[model samples]
Target chain A: MADFATIGQQFVQFYYNTFDVDRKNLAGLYRDNSMLTFESAAVAGTAGIIEKLVSLPFQKVEHRVDTLDAQPSSEAGGILVLVTGALKVDEEQKPMSYTQVFQLNPDGAGSYYIFNDIFKIIYSAA
Target chain B: MADFATIGQQFVQFYYNTFDVDRKNLAGLYRDNSMLTFESAAVAGTAGIIEKLVSLPFQKVEHRVDTLDAQPSSEAGGILVLVTGALKVDEEQKPMSYTQVFQLNPDGAGSYYIFNDIFKIIYSAA
Candidate 1:
C-alpha cells in the first residue's frame, strides 16, 4: 500500500489528469469497481467514471492539495483519506478557481478507487 | 481517543448541531482553535465559525451520515476521519438534501477541530 502522503499527492495528480482527459494516467488512479456520485446522481463503476472524467471540456485543470486528512475505517485494515484543496481550471486559458473534495482508499499494494469526487466552481465574477 | 466508528458518528451529529445554531453542543465537537473556510472565504477561529453557523436562517437543520471512511494521518497517533454523507435541512419544513464532507481527528482524550467542513446545497427544480 502507498503511504498517505504518496496517495494524497496521487489524488491531486489524478484530478488534473482526469479533468484534462489524460486517459493513460486516469486508468491507473481508479479501480475497476470504482464509482462516482455527482452531487446526488450516482455513476457506478470505473468505466462510467472514466467516461465522465474524459468528458470535461476544461483546457487545463490544476489542483492544489491544501490538506490530506486520513483515518481508519470501520473495517479493521481499511483506510479513508479525505483530500481537500483548490482547483484552477483553464477554460480558454482563463483561470477559474474551485474547491474539490476527494476520498480515497490507499492501502496495501493497491491505490484502489476514489470514494468521492466533488468540486464546485469558484471564480471572479465577470 | 474514540474509535473510528464513534468519531465518525460524532461528525454527523456535529454538522447538525453546528448548522442549527446549537452552540452549546457545538462546543464539544470542535477544538477551541477550530477554524472554518467557507467556499473560499476565510473564517478564523471557533468564534468566527460559530458566528457564521448561527447566522444561517434555515427553519431547521438536519444532518445525516451515509458512510464514514477513516484512514491514518501522517501523525503517528493522529487518525483522520473523512465523513461522507447526505444532509436534509428543514427550511420552512421543506426538505432540502445536500452533500457534506467533514475531516476530523478523533484520536483520544479530546476530539480536535474539523480539518475540513464543506457542503453544497442540492434541491429539486420546480
Candidate 2:
C-alpha cells in the first residue's frame, strides 16, 4: 500500500514549483492518454495540454494552495486528488480563487502519471 | 459504451435538483466507500457526507452551473466530472463562486454511484 497522503503532498509541491518556475517541464508528468480541461476548453494528450498551458495570458504566476484532499480511486493504485487555491498573476493585487482535480494512474514502473486534470479559475480580481 | 457526456449532464441536473429540493435523498447516490471533501474538511461514507451537507449554514439555496466537463476515467466505466458554478444561498444578493468534482463509478447494476466528491466555495459574497 502506498502512503497516498505523502504522495499527494509531494505531487502538489512538485507540480506548483514546476508550474511557477519552468512550466514546460511539467509536460513530462502527463501521458498520451492524459486529458486537461482548462475552464471550458478540453485538451487531450500531453502536447496539447502543454501547449495550452504555456500559452496562458500571464507570464508570471504564483499558486498558494489552501487545501488538498486525496482518495484511492482504483484497485490498480490510481489516486484522485482535489485542490483549492489562490492564484496571483501578473502583478495583480488580489489573488484569484481556483480549484483543480487530478487523476493519477500507476504507470507500472512504481510511478504515476496524470490521467485527467481539470482546472477552473472560480473568482477573478475586480 | 455509456454516453459519458449525457450521463454527466444528467447527473449534474439530478444532483443539484436533489441537493436543492431534498438534500437527504442525495445519500442514496453514495456508497460506503464514497468520500467527500467539502472545503477543508474531509468526510467519508454516506452518513458523514449527508450530515455535513444537511447541516450547512443556509437552508434555501440554488446552483447556477456555468461549465461542466466530463472525461472517461477507468476501464470499468468510471466518469470524472468537473463543474464550475455560482451558488446563491439564502437571500444574499451576490452569488458565491463554487467548484465541484464528482467521480462516478459503475455500480455493476447498470447505474453509477459517486465514489469521490469534492466541493469548495471559492468565493464568498462580500
Candidate 3:
C-alpha cells in the first residue's frame, strides 16, 4: 500500500488552494459520480456540485485551514480527510468555522479525486 | 418546528466548553446508547466513551473554535452540528485542528444529549 497519509495531506493543501483561487479548475478533481453535501443541500455529480458553488451567496472567500487529518478506508486506495477551518467571506467581521469531510479515491499517478464531501459551519462563540 | 439553527448553535458552544473543562462530567451529555467514533476506534455507550477519554495521553488542553454550523435532521428532535476548531494538548507548539460531527437529541426542557459523535484531527499545516 502507498503512503496514504502523505498523499492525503498533499491533496488537502491542493484542494483548498484551488478552491480559493480557481474554483472552476477544481472540476478536474471530481468525476461524473462525485457527491457533495453543502450544509443541508445534497448535490450529486461533478456538474451539479460546480453549479452549487457558482451559485453560492458569498462572492469573495478565503479559507484558512487549521487542521487536516487523513485516514485510510477499507476500500482499496480510498482515503478520508477531515478538515477544520475558518472561511472568510467578503468583509465579514468574523469568519465562519467549518468542518468538511472528504472521501478521496486514487485516480493513479499519486492523484486522487473527491468521491464524497460533507461540509457544515460551526457555532459562533459569541 | 422550533428554531433548530439557534438551538444547535447554543448546543455546540456548551458542548465544547464542557469538554475542555470537565471531561468527566460530559457523561451526562451522553446516554447509555450513545455512539462515538474517535479516530479509528468506535466506542458505544457512555461508559465506553468516558473510558476512552480517560485513556487519552493529553493532560492539559485548550480548544479554540473557529466555526460552527448546525441543521435539523429528519429524525424527530434531532440536530446535527458540525464543529471546526483547534486543539492544543499539553505544551504542543502547533495546535491540531479538528472537525467533529455531533448528532444531538433533545431530552426535553431545552436539554440535549449526544446520540452520535464523530471526530478527527486535521493535517498539520507545516
* Chain A alone, TM-score per model: 0.63, 0.95, 0.91
TM-score of model 3 relative to the true fold? 0.56
Candidate 3 local lDDT, B1-126, one digit each (tens): 458678877777787788788787789989886777787577878999999876888887788877666654323566656677778888886777677877677777667888767787755322
lDDT of 3 by residue, A5-124 (tens): 687778888988888886777888888777777875878788898988878887778898776666553235666667777888878867776778776777776668887677877653
* CA lDDT of every candidate: 0.51, 0.87, 0.73
Ranking by lDDT: 2, 3, 1
Model 3 spans > 4 angstroms off:
A108-110, B1-51, B54-126
Mark the 10 consecutive residues where model 3 chain A has the least summed lDDT.
A71-80
Q: What is the TM-score of chain B alone in each candidate?
A: 0.65, 0.95, 0.90
The residue-by-residue lDDT of candidate 2 on A75-117, one tens digit each, is 8888888888888888886877788899998888888899989
Docking class of 2: medium
Ranking by TM-score: 2, 3, 1
Task: Report the lDDT of model 3 for residue A34.
Answer: 76
Candidate 2 regions with alpha-carbon error over 4 angstroms: A124-126, B124-126
